[model samples]
Every structure is written in structure tokens, then in C-alpha cells.
Target: MKNVLVTGFDPFGGESVNPALEAVKCLAHLKTETYAVEVREMPTVFGKALDCLYAAIEQVKPDLVICVGQAGGRPQMTVERVAINVNDARIPDNEGNQPIDTPVVPGGPVGYWSTLPIKAIVQELNRQGVPAAVSHTAGTFVCNHVFYGLMHYIAESKAAIRGGFIHIPYLPEQAARQPGQPSMALETIVKGLKIAIDVAVELEEDIVTMGGQIS
Candidate 1:
């Protein structure tokens, strides 16, 4: 069975349950004849996020890596298109560190495009009655930092790891506190992620050979 490494962040922004972790955990239970899944949690802080992500990638040596994060106001699972080299956090991270207009990695490329088949994944989710879209920005927060770091490592290393990031919406309970915040059902988010992983692993061969075929 082929191995896939999935990552989600620990809770941040005073929230107790992050949908990212919950959704990925749901998908982790899927058993297949030819594929095995492993889900892990990473810190949401700038300095620690990348290190944790790298460690997972190295240990799992997965054929595909999908990083998930919380995007509170979104109404669906968003397949992020790009990760920019900037850290402009709206609030302090879990470690109480906030950076403004700083490079994710000094002297690295200005940005990195997601290696996942975003459109295909979104289409599959929508077919299952789950909301999904191709998000152009993963934001300047820790999500983007981890995304950029994963891409950077893939570019430099000889390891055959395909990486991308996904942003999930707020849980129903989280939105209840904020009168106007958009929220999605945890089950729907889980279903969307499962389809995403299946698509990611199924298309691994084409992804490696075609190189950035997602549009």
C-alpha cells in the first residue's frame, strides 16, 4: 500500500476545536486495499509549523502530502492555489509571536504553487454535495508559511513528495459565537477531505509526470 501523509494544525485564535484537524482525522480512518493514510498535527506558530511539517514528511516519506488549516470565515473546504513568501499575521500565533511583512524563508522564491490537483478535487467534492473551491491565497499567516516551506523542501530535496495545502471553514459551534461568521458542517468537511486525499493519491503518477497540471 502506498503511504500518504496528511497534516492539520493545532487549535489557534482561542478556538478549542479546529476543523482542519477534525476533518483530516475523519479521513485518516479510510482503509483501502492499495493505500494507507497517516494524519498528524503540527504547531500553528511560524517557526515551529515548518519544522513539524518537515519532520512528518521525512518520517512518513509519503507519496503525497496534504496540509490542512483553519480559515474561519470560509463556507467550504478551500484548495489553496499558492503560498506566498510573506508572514502578515492578523493575530499572534500559538507561541505568541506575530510577524508583519516578513519573508517565510529568507532569499527563497517569492511564492510556490500548490502541487495538488485542486480543480479535480473540488469537482469531486461538489459531486458529493460538499462545498469546495480553488483558493488563490492561503493567506499570509502560518498556513502560507507551512505551504511555502513544504514546496521549498520539495524543490531542494530528492524525495518524491507531492505537497499542497487546504483551508477548512469554521465549525458550527465556532460560527455560533460570531453572529455573522460562515460555517460548514464537520461531516461535510470530512467528506470533502476524504475525496481530496483519494484524488491526490489516485493522481500521484500524473502529478509527478505532468508537473503543475492543475489549473
Candidate 2:
């Protein structure tokens, strides 16, 4: 069976819980005939997040890696298409570090495309009655840092691993605290993540779909 490693960040921004980590914690040892899933919790800090991810990758030796992060205002699960090498944090991280326009890896490439079948995962999630879409950006926070670091590690080490990042909406409880914010139920988020994993494992290439933004 193919080994799959999924990661989520710890709660940041002073919230009680992080839906991404909670959902991943619920998916331990989720195994099927084709693939087996292992979960890891990454720090919300920029540099340390990548360090944790690299350790997890070494320990799990997974064929595929999906890193999930919380995107509070997003209404649906978004499979990121790219990870840029910039680190421009809008706010301080959990450790109170705020980087302004620093490259994630100095002198590295500008960006890295996700190796996973992003469109296929989005299509499958929508087919399963889950809200999902293809996202072009993973943001310039710790999420993007880890994503770019993972792709760079794969490229530099020549590892046979397909990796990508997914952003999930805030939980209902998290939204309850901030009025007028959109959120999705935990069950729905977990369902969407499982569907994404299944589709990513089954499909080799992304399907041709019109998933673009006008803005």
C-alpha cells in the first residue's frame, strides 16, 4: 500500500482550536487497499514548520504528502496550485515572528507547482457534494512556507513524493467567535479531506476543468 502523510498546523492567531489539526488528528491510521494515511501536526512558525515537516517526511517515508492549514474566511476546502518562495506575514505567528518580504529559501526558485492532481481532487470533492476549488495561492504565511519548503526538498533530494497544500475553512465554533465570518462543519471538512486524499491517490493527472478566478 502507498504511504500517505498528511499534516496540519497547530492553533494560531489566538484561537482555541485549529480545524486543520483537528481534522487530521481524526484521520490516524485511515487505511485502504491502495494507501495508508499518517498524520502530523506542524508548528505555525515559519522556519520551524518546515523543520517539523521534514522530520515527518523522513519518518513516514510517504509516497504522497498533503499539508492542511486553516483559512478562516474561506467557505470551502481549497487545493493549492502553487507555493511561492516569499514570506510576507500579515500578522505575527504563534511565536511572535513576523517576516516581511523575505524569501522562504534564500536564492531559491520563485515558486513551485504542486505535484498532486489538484484539479482532480477539487472535482471529486464537488462530485461528493463537498465545497472545494482549485486555489492558485497558498498565501505568504507559514502555510506557504511549508509548502514551498516541501516542494523544494523534493526537487533537491529527488524524492519520489507528490506533495501539495490544502486550505480549509474555520470551524463553526471558530466562526461563532467572529461574527459575519463563514465556516464549515468539522464533519464536512473531514469528509472533504478524506475525499481529497482518495482522489489524489487514485488519479495520476489532473482533469481539465475550468477552475480559474477573474480577479
Candidate 3:
């Protein structure tokens, strides 16, 4: 059975709960005849986020890693297309560390494409009634930080591990605080993630398709 490490961020930005972790926790104990899932909660801090991710990677040694984060205004599950080496945090992270125009890994490559079958994962999620698409930018925040760090680790270690990041919308309770913000049910997000993982494990090559933002 393949071991999969699914990670999610803790509550940040003065929020009490993070839907990403909530969904991930729901799948923590999943073990099938073909796959075994292990879930981890990552800190929302900038530098420390990667620290936790690295520790988790060391412990789990998963064949696949899918990092999940909260995107408050997003309406669907977004599979990131790439992780840039830049880190430009507009707001301070949980530990009040904010860096602008900095490199995620100094002297690292400009960016790294996701090793996961992202397009195929999105297609499967969408086919299951979960809104999903390829997201070009993970923003220059902790989400991007972790994404870039994971890809860097994979490249530097020369390990054949497939990894990518996925962003989920805010929970309904979170949206109640800010009127007009779109939110998705936690159950739906979990279902979408499960489908995403299933597709990622089953597909070796991504389906040819046009995906990403315009302009």
C-alpha cells in the first residue's frame, strides 16, 4: 500500500478554526487495501511552517504529499500549478514574521512545477461535483512557502516523491464574520480531497488540458 502524507495549516489570521485541517483530520485514519493516509497539522508561521513540514516528511516518508491551506475568498479547491522560489508576505504570519521580496530557499531555482498529476486530480474532483481547477499562484505566503520548500526538499534529496499544494475555501462559520465571502462545507471539502488523493495515486501522467489563470 502507498503511504500518503496529507498536511493542513492550523488556524491563523485571528481565526479559531481552519477548514483545511478539519478536512485533513477526517481522512487521517483512512487505510485501504491499496493506500494508507497519514495526516499532519502544519504551523501557520512562515519559517516554522517549513520546519514542521520537513519534520513531517522525515517521519512519514510518504510517496505522495498534498499540502492544504485556507484561501478565505476562494470558491473551490485549487490545485496549485507551481511553487515559486519567492516569498513576499503582505501580512505577518502567526509568529509575526513577514518577509518581502525574499527567496524561499536562497539561490534555489526560480520555481518548481508540481510533481503530482494535478490536472488529472482536478478533473476527477470536478467530475465528482467538487469545483476544482489549476491555480497558477499560491500567493507569496505560508502556503507558497511550504510548497516551495517541499519541492526544494524533493529536488535536493533526489527523492522520487510526488508533491503539490491545494487551497480550500473558508468554512461557513468563517464567512459569517466577513459578509459576502464564499464558503464551502467541510464535508464537501473532505470529499473533494479524498477524490483528489485517489486520482493522484491512480494516475501516472496528467491528462492533457488547458489550465491556469489568464493574464
Candidate 4:
């Protein structure tokens, strides 16, 4: 049985339920006879989120890592293609810290391409009738911060961890508050993530082939 580490953030932005964490928890139930899944939650702050995520990676030492976050304005599940080295948050994080034009890692490269098979994931999601796309930007918020940190850690560490980030749309409740926001049901998000995890584990061979072409 292979182990997979799944992570999501706790509620931020004055919301009661975060679709990121909710979807991760829902997908974590796929622990079956052939695979083991572990789900962890990280803080949504700047300096602390990356450290917590790396600690979880070290502790779990899973075969793959998928970090999920909320992108409220997006209309669908977005497979983020790059994590940039910037922290220009539009709103204060959970710790009440908002950074403007800050580097995610001082002296790190400007960006990191996602190690996950994003196009394949998008195809898989679309096959399931879930709207999905390749998102070029994870935003300059904490999501990008954590995503950049994960990629940087993978580049520098001895751990052979494959890492990527996914941005989910606003939950129905969240979208209801903002009249113009696009909303997706929690169940659909869960199903999409399950397919993503299944692909993350079951499609390693395809990942190598497609990843080479992508690079």
C-alpha cells in the first residue's frame, strides 16, 4: 500500500467552513486495502504555513503530496501550474498579517512549475463533469506562498516528494453571500479531489511520460 499526504488549510477570511479542508477530509476516506491516506490541516498564515506543511511532509513521508486551497473567484477546480515567489495578499491572513510585494523565499527562483500532472488531472476532472482548468497563477496570497515553499523544499531536500497545489472554488454557502461569485457543491469538490488523488497514485507511469513532454 502506498501512502499519500493530503493537506488543506483551516478556515480564514471570516468563513465558517473552508472548502479546501472540507474537500480534503472528504477525500481522505479513500484509505482502502491497497492504499493509505493521511490528511492534515495547516495554518493560513505567511511565515508559519510553509513550516507546518514541511513538517507534515517529513512526518508522513508520503509518496505524494497535494495541498488544497480556496480560490473564491474561480468557477471550478483549478490545477495550479505554477507557484510564484511572491506574497502580495489582498486580505490579512488568519494571523492578521498581510504582506505586500514580499518574496515567498528570499533569493529563491521567481517561480516553480508544479510537479503534478496538471493537464491529466484536468482531463480526469472534466471527464467526471467537473469544470477544471490549468491555472497559471495560484495568486500572490498564502496559497502561492505555501505552494512555492513546497516546491522549494522539494528542490533542496533529499526527500523524493512530488508536490502540487489545487485551488477550489467558493462553496455554496460562501458564494451565496457574494451574489456574483461562482459556487460548487461540496460533494462535487470531494469527488473531483478523489479522482485527483487516485490519479496521483495510480498514474505514476503516465505522469513521467507526460511530465517529460510538459517540461
Candidate 5:
């Protein structure tokens, strides 16, 4: 069976939990007749997240990699369209590393578009009644850090390992602490991720659709 690795981050920013990890834990070792999924928890630090990601890539030698993270205010599992080649941290990472306006790779490309069928993933998730959308920015934090690193690694190594990043909203409990912030149930996030993975594995060509924002 073809192997696919799903990675998620550990808790950071003074939060006791990360929805990404929670979803990853729920998705471990998911298998079908055609492909399999292996899950790993990456550090929330800048350099170390990439290290853990690369190590997992080496270990799994997956055909696809989906990196998941928490986006506190969003109510949907937003499939990121691109990862920029910068790291500008608004706050320190888990290990207290704060990088500002630094290239993820010193001379790398400005950005990398996700190789997965992003539009298709969003379509599938919404069709299932799980909220989702195409996100234009992964942000310059650790999530973007790893996203860029993964793309750089894929480009440099000349590997056929298709990669992408997905951002999930906070869990209900996380949002409960801060009123007016939207959140999705953990099970909803898991279901959306499963659909995304399936679409990534099965659909090589992304569907043509409108997922644009004027503002």
C-alpha cells in the first residue's frame, strides 16, 4: 500500500492543547486497500518543526504529506493555497524562538503553491457539511515555516512527494475561553481531514473552481 504521512504540531502559545495534534491522533494508521496514513507530531518551534517533518518524511517515504496546524479564530479547516518564504513571528514559538522577516531558506523561491488538490479538498469538505475554504495565507509563523521548508525540501530533492498545509480552527473549549471566537468540533475537523487526504491520494489533477477573494 502507498504510504501518506499526516503531521500536526504540539501545543504552543500558552495553550494546553493543539487541535492539529488532536486530529492527527485521531487519524493515525488509517488504511484502505490503496493507501495508508501515518501520523506524527511536530514541534512548534521554527527550526525543529522542519527537522521533525524531514525526519518523518524520511521515515515514511510517503507519497503525500499534509501538515496541519491550529488557526484560532477560523471556523473552518482552511486548505492553504501557498506558503511564503518568510518567517515573521508575532510571538515566540514553543522554544521561545522569534524570527522576523527571515527567509525560510536564504535564497529559496518567494513562495510555493501546494501540490495537493486544494479546491477539490474544500469542495469535498463543504459537500460533507464540514466548513472549509481555500486560505491564501499560511502566515509567517511556525506553520508557514514548516510549509516553506517542506516545499523547499521537495523542490531540492526532486522528489515526487506531493505536499500541502491545512489550518483548522480551535476546538470548542479553546474558543470558550475567548468569547466571539469561532471554533469547530474535533470530530468535524477529523472528518474534513480524512476527506482531504482521500482527495489528495485519489485526485492527481485539481478541479477547476472559483475560490477567490476580492479583498
Candidate 6:
């Protein structure tokens, strides 16, 4: 059976509850016949996020890793297609570090494509009536920082592991304060995540489809 490590960031940006974290916590005891799932809680800080992720990787030695983060105002579960090496945080991280125009890894590749079957996961989620799509950008915040760092580690170590990032919308309570901002139910988010994990563990290649955006 394959081993999969799923990670979610702690609440950040003045939020009390992060949907990603809550959903991941719910999945901690998930059992499947083909693969075992492990959950890790990562700080929303830039550098420390990667540190926590790396430690979990070393401990879990997972075959696949899916790092999840909360993306306020987003209406769907976006499976990121690529992770840029830049960190241009519009707001400070949980540690109060607001880095602008900084490279996640000095002299590293400009970006890294996700090794996960992103399209397949999106397709499966959509088929299950969950709002999901392939997102081209993970944004230049701690989310991207962790995503880029994870992919870079895999490249540098040449490990046989597939890793990617997913962004989830805010929870219903979170949007209640924002008035018009969209938020998904916690149970729905958890259902989507479970489907995403299933597709990631079972599908080896991504399915080609029309999951793109236009300016």
C-alpha cells in the first residue's frame, strides 16, 4: 500500500479557524485499502512551514504529499499546477515576516511544476459535485513558499515522491464576517479533500482537460 502525507497550515491572517486545517484534522484517522494517510499541521510562517513539512516528510517517508492552505475569497478547491520560487507576501505571515521580492531558494529554478495528477484530482472532485479546478498560480505567499520548497526538496534529493499543493476556500463562519465573500461548508471541504486524496493515490497520470483561465 502507498503512503500519503497530507499537510494543512494553521490558521493565519487573523483567522480563528482554517478550513484546510480543520479538514485535514478530520482526515487524520482516514483508512483505505490501497494507501495509508497521514496528516501534518504546518505553521503559516514562511520558512518554518517548510521546516515542519520536511520534518513530517522525513518521519512519514510518504510516497505522495499534498500541502493544503487556505485561500480567502476563493470559491473552489484549486489544485495548483505550478509553484513559483518567489515570495512577495502582501501581508505578514504568522511570524510577522512580510517578504517582498525574495526568492524561496536563491538560484533555484524559477518555478516547479506539480508532480501530482492535478487534473485527475480536479476532474474527480468536479465529478463528485465539488467546486474544483486546476489553478495556474499558488500565489506568492507562504503557500507558494511551502509548495516551492517541497518540490525543490524532491528535486534536490531525487526522491521518488510526488508532491503538490491545494488551496481551499474559507469556511462559512469566516465569510459571515466578510459579507459577500464566498465560503464552503466544512463537511463539503472535507468530502472534497477525501476525494482528492483518493484520486492522487490511485491515479498515476493526469487527465488532459480544459481547466485553464484567460486574462
Question: What is the lDDT of every predicted structure here?
Answer: 0.85, 0.94, 0.92, 0.87, 0.94, 0.93
Model 5 local distance difference test score: 0.94
Q: List the residue pairs that clash in candidate 5.
A: none
* lDDT: the better of candidates 3 and 5: 5
- After the best TM-score superposition of candidate 2, give how far the Cα of residue 8 lies from its true spot, in angstroms: 0.5
Q: Model 4: residues >4 Å from true position, as ranges?
A: 205-215
Q: Candidate 4 lDDT, tens digit per residue, 1-215?
A: 87788899999999988999998887665786656888998899998998899888889888888999999999989998899998999999999999999899999999998888787888889988999888888999888999999999999885677879999999999999999999899999988888888777766543322322243
- Residues 76-127 of candidate 1: C-alpha lDDT, one tens digit per residue: 7889889999999999999999999999989999999888888788877887
Cα-lDDT of candidate 6: 0.93
In terms of TM-score, which candidate is stronger, 3 or 4? 3
lDDT of 3 by residue, 1-215 (tens): 89999999999989999999999999987988779999999999888988999899899889999999999999999999999999898888898998999999999999999988999998888889999889999999999999999999999999778999999999999999999999999999999999988988988789998786668
Candidate 1 vs candidate 4, lDDT winner: 4
Q: Please give the lDDT score for candidate 2.
A: 0.94
User: Residue 4 in model 1: shift from native, Å?
Assistant: 0.7
- Tens digits of per-residue lDDT, candidate 6, 1-215, equal 88889999999888899898999999996889988889999999989999899999999999999999999989999999999989999999988999999999999999999998999999889889999989999999999999999999999999999999999999999999999999999999999988988888888788888888895
Error of 5 at 176 (Å): 0.4
Give me candidate 3's TM-score against the actual structure.
0.98
What's the TM-score of each model vs. the native? 0.92, 0.98, 0.98, 0.92, 0.99, 0.98
lDDT of 5 by residue, 13-126 (tens): 999999999999999989998899999999999998999999999999999999999999887899999999999999999888999989999999999999999999999999
Candidate 2 positional error at 177, Å: 1.0
Candidate 3 lDDT: 0.92
Q: List the residue pairs that clash in candidate 1.
A: none
What stretches of model 2 exceed 4 Å from their correct place?
none
Model 5: worst 10 consecutive residues (lDDT sum): 1-10
Give the distance in Å from residue 11's predicted Cα in candidate 2 to where it truly belongs.
0.4
Query: What is the C-alpha lDDT profile of model 2 across 18-57, one tens digit per residue?
Result: 9999999999999999999999999999899998999999
